[model samples]
Target: MPDQSPSSRRFRADSCFVTGGALLALLVVGGLFWAKYNMSTVKEWRGGNAWNLTYEAAAVSGDPRAAAVRYRHNPDSFRKDFRDERLGAIRLPWHTEANVNTGAVARMEVAPAGEGQVSCRILLDGVRVVAEGRSPAPGEPAVCEVTTSSTPEKWPTKPS
Candidate 1:
């Protein structure tokens, strides 16, 4: 080319550096936004996985009431109690958060169903019927396995 001054060459190099830097920064910012937008989808996936694992464990254990209690205390405990290595790999940020509580128990009524059994009706969270079974009259107790249809939508959006 014609005579190009040293200052002009340096300016060109600087402009190239600045443009590359801006592009890189823009990509990083875009990635962060993408991750934020998909966070709910990720949580939804995790919740579904957890619920399925819990349901399997409860079904096998044949104790819905105990399962419900355990879920209340620690939702992630099922993965551990059942030795689910797959689920253990995915850690949830809100593992200790309670999804259901005593206040969620809308109603619980027990009455005699027969000589040795009592009818039980337990409602939870004004929506789910946690338990309904004919339990033993006194000594022996019936098992009521309660599960939630709760998805990530039910989970707290903000950190607790």
Candidate 2:
């Protein structure tokens, strides 16, 4: 039993149109994000044609406090090899081995809990160097990573 004039109708339409436009925009963005996630995160999940991989890392320039060595070779989960929540931080010179496969990504990261220089190495077939990373600064990470599908044997860059 209120006003149903042209101006009131127009205001209601404008409000609904703004709300609908926002919803549509959110839907489009979410769809694009889901597509990209499926493309990278799920594409190499199977990790076909297995191979042995080794990840090694060393951190120098240590403080009295400790640091963390983190790594991942397959798509499943990353590992922080030497971390104890109850205790203080741990020093580094960490290594691990993984059975990876084609189309898999191998990565190593050094997260310094304190002041330090960090570096990492990835080896394929137990002898050949595949990838390496070094910490950029005292606070930044030194990350070394590589995709296994890119002819690991043909790669000639060795760690020093």
lDDT of 2 at 101: 50
Model 2 spans with C-alpha error above 4 angstroms: 1-48, 64-66, 75-89, 150-160
Every candidate's lDDT: 0.37, 0.64
Q: Write the per-residue lDDT of candidate 2 for residues 1-160, one digit (tens) a residue.
A: 9899999999999999999999999999999999766754453453244457787767656652336666654433232232211223555666678755555566666676666777778888768877887778886667887776533224336456
**Candidate 1 lDDT, tens digit per residue, 54-96?**
1111111222222121223223422422221112211111122
Q: Which prediction has the highest lDDT against the true structure? A: 2
Runs of candidate 1 exceeding 4 Å displacement: 42-48, 51-160
Model 2 local distance difference test score: 0.64
